[model samples]
Target: MKTKESKKKRTEIQAVDLFCGVGGLTHGLILGGVKVVAGVDLDSICRFPYEANNAAAFIEQDVKTLSGKTVRKLFSERGLKLLAGCAPCQPFSTYSRGGRKSGINEDWELVASFGRLVREVQPDLVTMENVPQVEQHPVFQEFLSDLHGYHVSWSVVECSSIGVPQTRKRLVLFASKFGPEGLSISESNRRKVTVKDAIAHLRPVVAGQADKKDPLHIAPRLSDLNMKRIKASRPGGTWRDWHPSMRAACHRKVSGDTYPSVYGRMEWNQPGPTMTTQCFGYGNGRFGHPEQDRAITLREAAMLQTFPVGYRFLKKDEKAKFSLLGRLIGNAVPVRLGEVIAETLKSHVAFYASAEKRECA
Candidate 1:
């Protein structure tokens, strides 16, 4: 049951967030006027932040146990329930797809299982997001097949096109049971937000000094040698510019040409390279600050993900660890992209609601 405040706040639409990692999608739905009542995730690390920002209860439950009864009670309504989730994508990601397919990665099975929950819960609408590579995976194919009765549509949308400052592409899908017509989202054609627009205001702080206004935005500690490596690498330059002594052994060989993303720096005017889990490392991808000495801070990574600057992911009294929070922010969906998904689905729901009422009368 929802608390009195929650019941009033969420009078618009109700949502149950599955696999809610730090509540990125949930935040987007909230911004779109949906009330997210509960979020389920196996990671305890997500609870603090997920609950702090959204008026939702964070349940640390493995989603395999999820069912309609549990979901219905949490939502406290039978009207147009929304089921949203992003199954862990590490297994179906391009990185894993490029590797040998010998052993089974459990995360691969979770995608289809997410489909099972959708069928069982029978929510009025569904939305999912994953790496672009997932669209080609066999498990995703099966999930689509399972959603056969719904009005379904999907595409590999560029995150930057939707106002995310990072150049990340994700496969987004929407399914609704309200009609026979297929659903499609209008693509945003606006100019992409650049790296400078995302992180330009902060005062320069070398590797260790935390920003006084936002400590969570502090960059990671750098080694003395790596510090020199970053200084040698100009914006948009690679290790090729480094003196012979500074080159890593792998980069010195002909085969090293394959690993071009290493020791790169961002172009101030363009969208940033995708913010991966290791984006806090200056040597990883084009993650170096365009002008600052250190790598982009945790706050900057989240901003590039299109998360608001004041978005809080940790308790005020917590240690405010940089590397740990960087990992979380880097991996989250750009909240704006999530909002796009919600808005698209909302239009579809409105159309169906009108149709259903006409049919009943």
Candidate 2:
């Protein structure tokens, strides 16, 4: 009764966000005028932020165990149904593919699970985002098989193309039952925002300090060794800038100079390196502040990921933990990118609906 009444208030186009990490994509869809009824993710920690910020229900169920009938119950029986997800990307990430680390057995099958549900539910529109390498995997091929009767399109999207001030690339796939022309978003023509443009205005806080007004603006404590490395580090320069004695053993090897960004600083003019689960650590990637002695704060990282300022990751003054927030903000689909995706979907739906109306008239 209450559920039926609640469904009445939403727009004709409704969506469910699977693997909805901390509501990044859900928030973007809502901002773009799509009525997201609920978000589904396995992480229990995702519940609060996904619900608090998005005004949607967060169902903490692993997609593997989630049933299509369960998901179907959440959507209205009337309107255009949409399914959106960013499957656990670690299995196909460059970092993982380079033999650094790969996800568990379950993660390998998540894409298949996503495909299974799509086969069962048959939504009007389906969208997915993942590391570009996923498109090469047999599982991704199998996932596309699930879209047999629909129009499918995919592209490896540069995050900067969507105005996100970060160096990250993702493969976006769109499938629609609407016929030959499928939904696909082009580059947002908006001027790209730079590192300086994104975070230069925040008050500078040194290593191991948190601002009184913004707890998330805290930077991690640097080690004596890394402290020296950061001091000698120049913006856009690699470990090559460091004195030979100061360079890490890994960098000294034949392959040492290969990953120079390991201890590098972000240039003010360019987008920052891709945010990862450890983005707050100075030694991780090119995360050091351009001129500051410490690494960029969680706030700066979030900003680079295009999460709006004052975006709440914790309860009022609940305190911020670097590891936790790093994973949440790092894994989030940049809010801006999500917005671009949603806006594109809205335009696609409108165009088709109008064309159909004219045909009927």
Candidate maximizing TM-score: 2
What is the lDDT of every predicted structure here? 0.77, 0.84
Q: lDDT tens string, model 1, 247-296?
A: 88999899999877687778888999998877888877788888777888
Candidate number achieving the greatest lDDT relative to the actual structure: 2
Clashes of each: 0, 0
Model 1 accuracy (lDDT, Cα): 0.77
Per residue, candidate 2 scores C-alpha lDDT tens digits across 1-361 of 2354433332256899998978988988888877899999877777887888887899988788999999899997777899998888574432233334456555668889899999989998898988898887789999999999988998988988788899789888888887545377787767777899999999999899998999999999998999999999999998898898898888878987678799889999988889888899888889999999999999999999888787778888688899888988888888887888888777777777657657866
Model 2 gets an lDDT of 0.84
lDDT of 2 at 174: 88
Segments in model 1 whose C-alpha atoms lie over 4 Å from true places: 1-12, 91-103, 180-182, 354-361
Model 2 error, position 336 (Å): 1.3
